[model samples]
Target: MAGAGWAPPRLDEFILTEPLGSGTYATVYKAYRKRDTREVVAIKCVNKRSLNRASVENLLTEIEILKTIRHPNIVELKDFQWDSDHIYLIMEFCAGGDLSRFIRTRRMLPEKVARVFLQQLACALKFLHDRNISHLDLKPQNILLSSPENPQLKLADFGFAQYMSPWDEKHVLRGSPLYMAPEMVCRQHYDSRADLWSVGVILYEALFGKPPFASRSFAELEEKIRSDRAVETDLVVEAVRKDQEGDASAAFSLYRKALEYFVPALHYESDARRKEAIRAKVRQYISRAEELKVLVTSSNKNLLEKGNPARELLKEMAKDKPRLCAALEVASAAIAKEEEGRDDSDALELYQQSLGELLLLLAAEPAGRRRELLHAEIQTLMARAEYLKDQIKMREAQSMGKEALAESVRSGCTLQ
Candidate 1:
């Protein structure tokens, strides 16, 4: 309540221009402060007499949550007024409308644009979840864009939001069926993970032009969510799309979630063929990891060359670089062993290329603590590369010797 006084202001203090929209409990209006005509805001007017006790409590809860949280990607609550007839909430006006309308006009957003919005939404949700708040209802209709051109998203509509502890169990279903988590649909205990599941649904809709679990009826939709049948292939495609759009973090996060499904399938699989199929799925995750690493390294190089001041990007790379390098080493060794009696050129090439990408980072860094660590990594990789090269050469020599012996045996047989 930045400019609000102790008492509620008269409706005359604002000039209501046009009706933004109407909801079940409230009507939104585009309005301006009378004192400053240049300043515009959205007024959500809720009729007090029109609601039951539960609805009133929910409205008050929204106000409480909105007042406590302030973020760039979250709509701001600037002022409020309580009168005998109505409760007016003054909020930041978003001229670009909600994301649902935006998506409707475009059919589906381009991968780059969707990736940007998803990252922003993830950051906003992370902020809320870190503070123990669950939005409970997250969808395109609730995501407002700042403007048509910029399309900066702001999370709105907190009527169903709840504040819960990490260990608290939630069994109440309080969201749209299409966006609801499986636990929510099943009336089982859930937590902040439900919001993340909603995010996945939103991401799917953004990418595929329709919700993954879409159905004509609520029952069918619930069944789809409970089974999570539509998400398997779509998740992988969306992950790869994000990687192509150069959003390594989002791509990696999606791939990691996809990997979770395969892990359970692999564990419970009794049939050898089905187990092999699960192993192939696991290998896809490994491939995604490698692709993400390549994208991250390329972006890091560009940032370094341009002298960009994106410390967060640098921090992410530094944090994950070791684990990524270790995975690559393990994959290389496994492939080499698997191809021991055959040509292991592909495995050797993969090892060398991944090592080269790691070494490239050393050139971009100045001599410091980080550079020192990179030097140590380079030493380790060089040793591994040498060992792999020797193995390849020995295999090749053995192969050549066997060929020569076969040739001699053929010649002796012909002479006989």
Candidate 2:
């Protein structure tokens, strides 16, 4: 199934086309069902002769695991069949290919885009964690995208996965070398946390365009991982990590450190487009850092719960109105997002959606306690919307004073 001229084994109900990918024992093909709908699928054709004893066991384990579990972010195994010469695994087709190709084509992903993918990956991992499953082989090549446009991440290639709980430690080495956790490589016992280390590597590769220890030889990679020297850190990346983790105090400090680096980088950068992007990101971080400063001084809980009394009263008053209560809940969720400070744009969009529903409901209701509370909630959401708009505007603006100063310097140089 792996070598050239190896035709895909015929399936009774599906027509196999070109090969999508090839591995040691199998080749995946893009196929279509023979039914009127002609639905698309991926068929993994594993040549019987290619399977070693261990690979045979892995295949059986993979089939058992995939058949029993289902999650939104995990690739679905629709069906499995085996003939005398080959085994066929019918899977959901992903049009966007694998994450490795996606990143390779882009060179590197924007932080926002990388964060979105990380979130999806984490979601899938959580599902596995709940079921006491660990995907030991977590790498970009094993991750699939649902489609080319606005693709959804799908975790695939679970041949190395196992029914290991968080506390279950294993000494057997598994997974790709570059993406493997240090414990696994050192021949030490490791549990589900090994998968997390791989996740960190995936995120690092996504943001930086390469893993932390990209090397030409096995010795170089091992030395980098096992050496005493700390890997060079990026201030902005550190700041964002802390911010996402809700460590406002640490994030505030890191953001300030990032600004120290960004200011000099901005001044030194000659590329106008790159400078503008950096300037905008600096402004956004500045806004978030200022917000974090206040959050550090005051309890984030207090800031969030400041309006809880009114919200509680509104919820109680709107007991008779299910639609109104649902809208109020959506508004609450939007507030939570804003407080998290993970993505202001997402928070703003949520606020807009919630406001649209609340405004209509308010107009329908007569003047009363519920109406009064609803009105207050609407005003609060409007203020948040305005604040987010100002943040966006500030991030976009190029300083007039700086531009004028540069113009004067250029004119002086010309005269000289």
Candidate 3:
């Protein structure tokens, strides 16, 4: 039975069990709500008498931001209390501790595990960005793990978070120097992309066991961050150029090189979410390479006559039926175009093969709009195959007529 006449719960209502940590602003404690002893929370108690005007405003900002944001990956703020001397914020207690501690203990996370963290962090960032919130201070220390066994991550510490519109041109520089973006280090205005740059630093550290740039002095670090080149980024750029230039082999090689960088990460990663993200990228690159190989080899008679590697690639890709069907469709179209005004037997064969793969996909596809689309595509391919058959027959007939006429002419002349 709770009523307005019931006195508000005092600071003693939450019995502090242990000291968790202390920061520049406040000390945190592991505590239990007395009414329900099972309910545990981390209470951040700030002494008001010691704070200046600016500090109080920063504290208020953090509270305002936390109160408005509700996300699974963001720490939950449960309750708050203010007395004449101090303010207390009761938040969800994470028993596993901060990510910084986890990383310190693990040394370097496997790429898969890093990817899992990256995905959740990215999702949290997107959620904040969507609402015009920028977490100016995003670092491993600000991320907490809910439990040791399951290890669900939650972003915490919003003291430096702020709301900024795209049109805003001015912003004060704040955040750890190691994770700061180039623009921020330069003391220039930046936007949400700055947060992504911090995320990139975290990702690099997670994968390589160290940040991309390091220096004894902050100035040197800033210089390194600005000038440092990412090998994978360069490879991706080159791959795209080669792809656009119609050099499928070169492009495929570059993409493979780019993918190799992630192999170590994937091999050591233990998290499923991270593993899947890496795997998805792997599939994308492989599928693209297969598609290009088909295009390059389809028109080359020499390549086809020498045991077409394009066909082999398609056979391999067929293991993933959806990807195989897509590759076959592209190959079929390219072959049809190349065979125009020439022998179309190759094109006819490709069409039939594509039809076969499409039928397999159609069979596997469930009853839905997607199945309907597959059925329509299959019908169109069948019609094209039929047309190719008729054209081939007409061409054969024309060849036979020409040979008979030539023989008659020779017989009439009789070696005159």
Give each model's whole-structure lDDT. Answer: 0.72, 0.81, 0.70
lDDT of 2 by residue, 354-397 (tens): 89999999899898877888898788777666555544433332
| Clash tally for model 3 | 0
Give per-residue CA lDDT, model 3, range 199-239, as digits (tens). Answer: 98887776555666766777888777655233244556778
Write one digit per residue (lDDT tens) for candidate 1, span 171-285: 8789898898888777778887889888988977886678877788777877765552324555578888998887785676566555644555554555555455555566667
How far is 393's C-alpha from truth in model 2 (Å)?
13
| Model 2 quality (TM-score) | 0.57
Q: What is the TM-score of each candidate against the true structure?
A: 0.55, 0.57, 0.54
Best by lDDT: 2
Off by over 4 Å in 2: 1-6, 232-416
- The number of clashing residue pairs in each candidate reads 0, 0, 0
State the displacement of the C-alpha of residue 224, model 3, in Å, after optimal TM-score superposition: 0.8
- Candidate 3 lDDT (Cα, whole model)? 0.70
